[model samples]
Target: MSYLMMFYSAFFSTSVSASETAATANPMRSQVVADLVEFLIEAGQYLGMKLEQGSMSYQLFALGSIFLVAFASFILAKLILHFKVLRLVSRSNNTWDDCLMEAGVFRRIARIVPGIVVYTTYSLFFEPEDKLYSLLANFSAIYLLFTAWRTLSGSLTAIENIYSRSLLAKKAPITGFIQVTKLLLTLVLIFLLLSLLLGKSPIYLLSGLTAIAAVLLLIFRDTILGFVAGIQIAANRMFNTGDWIAMPKYEVDGEILEIGLNVVKVQNWDKTISTLPTYSLTTDAVKNWRGMTESGGRRIKRSVYLDIHSVSFADAELLEEWEGMKLLNQYLKDKKQELVEDRKLKEIEETDILNCRRLTNLGTFRAYLTSYLKKHEMINQDLTCMVRQLKPTEIGIPLEIYCFSKEKNWVAYEQIQADIFDHVLAILPVFKLRAYQRVSSHNEQAQKNAQ
Candidate 1:
């Protein structure tokens, strides 16, 4: 092995000068490699074997030596990466290095070591004009290219992970961009691989690609559309990871798990995963709730239908009873004074309840709800908050509460909403109101028989 090292070093030193010659088109066609093979054959003869230049014995020894050297180089590179590079990365305060480590960028780079070692030293084992030499060269080149691809892909992944931690990532993600770059990298790798395999220039092969451009387009139609959609989504500051988006067209209603080049993954509320094409996000109607999340409020728009038969004007008894309530006392007192003054000015009699400015139970209930919501701890007072009646339907008059909740979390918001409706339904009877309930066939028959 010591002699072998000396041979390699001396071979490289001489090959540098020999490579400058016009006749030396291939650097692997070295006189030093020829000398090394002759030395191996002589050594084999000294061992009392019937050895010759092209003998199986000499070739086996040479091939085994190449494997040993390539394996040693690979192990050395891996050890250096683990002890030196990884140690430094682990100690670094910056998170990006950790991301790179996790992405296996260093590991992928280490895999190139064996290919490089084999490429430089393989000529020593066989004559440059031998078929084995060409085969080894091709294999080494392909191995290098493949390892380079892995390294570059890992680098891109590390880049995306680093960018995801930035504040800008929440506004505009780069995952799609990273994926698009990977796709381009793959295409380039394929072109280079084809050129290498076919023994042609990359540019020559690329020129031929123009003839099959339509087929390529059809094959990569979604990929091409996704790239364009990704650009639009990023530039326009569209939805990002963790955003709750609803694309009914795709039956997707969930928080975005990932946004990639070709697809956007959403984890639906039912815990089912939905995958939508990236282009579909741009072309289809996707409702992004990022605005609500960023605004620190989640809108709540719901209706409580009150049985129309239960609604009536507030009588003197009802007003007096509501005056003792904390939420409605001041409101009732203020309205009473305003109404008394208005009636006196208009010369209207209090006996005429319709003409006189008296409060209805529905109106007073709306005011109470408004005041209650304004003071509720969980509701966002800064945003729109109101309670009003909707047009009476066959079933009932809908009292709609339109407001936003301070809690933006799904579970918390749901709990807050539930709490509000619970309070509304429980307190409705106090206003002499009843929630509309559909009559069952059994109850309808009983009612009809009683009537």
Candidate 2:
């Protein structure tokens, strides 16, 4: 095969010079020259031309040589993959190489063996001047580019998966960044491949991109915005995977499952997924419940209205009754003594109910609520806990309970709130305070029957 390739190279060199001299000496002989060359070539080939004379036999030998080289390279590559490289890669603890193997990066590199053999043997089958050799070389280059692209892309995806599962990734995720890098790499490779196909320098082709920069930006506006937003989100710690966020503008109220370059996926409380543009998080309002979850308690703010007619100064009988109640015994006794002494010192008439500082049922009920919350096991004592009155309305007086529940979980917190309210409602009558309710037909009918 080597001898045939050498002979063909020598013969083509001499024949090209001879044809050039013949054409220059007699221009009209060019057609006759081509025909004579073809006849001699066909006749010599039929006559069983030998390698010793550098004839068409050498061309057949060269063609056979190329096929043999290709076959040998393929077998060698397969053997290397099976017995040598893949096993070694798979045995290592370093998963990057394993990923490469799984993604066929190694296999793609192995293909280079066959490609090199084919390229080196290409000249054996045909002269450099032949159009087929040039076409084959071009096609091979294109195929090589495609193989490299596939290998790189697959390896990137594998790497991304591995990295996304790592400890560092848990604290600071970079999946979006990695994906963007892969996309840019692909674009660069595509541009290089295009330059090779056009027989132009990559720089020359890239220079034209400057002119279309605006158009490119317009086409990829969303992607650009998302990329920027992703950076901002990461740097600011605005949101992360598994964060509960509520965005009313996009109707997304859920935990963020993924943050991508162009979109953020949220798994709603109902288990439905909502896709939101990445930029929207930066530009619009979103409520992140991470703070609440991290806090010691969950806020509880609620109001209970009291009937105005149910409120009155605590008289001796009522005070004595309240004193018997263990929860408010000390408070009632102290207040009653203080009121009596103040009235006597100020020389105010004891019969005048409004003349001195006196405990009202509504005020006592508010105090009871505050004390109850402070002692409640589910309420966080470390945080502010207050039971106070808001401005009275036409229906009644507004008693607002402001406190924090110790439990932060949704269900537990709700249960605690319900229990607290239940106790408060039940004990309201004990304080001689009635929850405001509209007069109904039942009350009117009972009153008429009694009359």
Candidate 3:
């Protein structure tokens, strides 16, 4: 306890001497604080306590006081911002202010208050020649720089939030660009921070770092590529969020969730997440279904095989039966009239069915399918709707139905396509045509036994 008292006496005496000198040399130093220190030292000495002047303890005390003042100032700033600034922001009807607050822009801005306080008042606690003063000044500058970085970063976040609500965001997402800007800002901050810590100019450090440019390139190869690719993507307006992209090479087929600086996130149809480097979007061959989506229709290109043996000329009875059908009524009338004119033009007799331009059952079936698609509610009539026959394969003749569906949704499109094919297959027997199917051994044996 006695040693502690002596230490206090010596510390106060040193503080008093240093404060007096500081007050005389620097007009900005607080005279009242210096007088308080002097009075404490004089009172302790008058009470028969041994005292000394100008000790290392005084410098330590001044440095400690500067840090203490900075801490207290930070708390006070927070209290003021919470009660005054934050309340005002919250009560306002502005959406921008709300975004800024939510992103902590104001909070991060308030962080500089302590650094400012320390910077402005450091001289009051230490002289111009004091090493502690230089140290505090450098520290406060770095602190302010960091606070500025945080505030700016938060502001960028707020900007992104504001942009996300706009209609254009869906078509032209700026996330990659924003991330690139943030990365550049972070690099600048790092350089500045390094300059301050090393007591060197940023230009000098940048020049020195040029020697390691190759090493830096190797380290940030992906980042550089992504940055370049991001620029290309934005400039070209290739794809955006919610666009369905298929990259078979990567086994990725999904909607884009996010386009970031390093990677793009995809939410697959199966609810699984896929991540690919942003550069890959530029380098890779990806199919964007946005055109199909924007066209408001999805194509259905599928073929149904038919037994070639079932293809025969339409006889009189079959022609009469198809003529009565409502869907084929007008079609048959036009065809019969055209056939009569054609047979007259070529001087061919109707009794000579082999030489006449008569319609085959396969051709009639194809015509019926075309008319059915034209009248179907789900098929888009404005687009190319066709039923064409392809070359015969070993299996059968390929009768392909190519059309766009009114319903572009996957499930709805599938249902529409299934309904069309179901109707076609069921009505095939009416035309006396068979959908070709490979006969299984069991069916062949059963047929033989039945015969």
lDDT of each: 0.83, 0.75, 0.82
Best by lDDT: 1
- Candidate scoring better on TM-score of 1 and 3: 1
Collision pairs in model 1:
none
Put the candidates in TM-score order, highest first: 1, 3, 2
All candidates: CA RMSD (Å): 6.2, 9.8, 8.5
The C-alpha TM-scores of every prediction are 0.86, 0.73, 0.85
TM-score of 1: 0.86
| Per-residue lDDT of candidate 3, residues 46-157 (tens digit) | 7675434334555565566567877898898889989998899889988888899999998887789888877766655455567776677678777877888888888998
Provide the lDDT at 451 for model 2. 100
Preferred candidate (TM-score higher): 2 or 3: 3
Residue 228, candidate 2: Cα error in Å is 1.4
Tell me the lDDT of model 3 at 134: 68
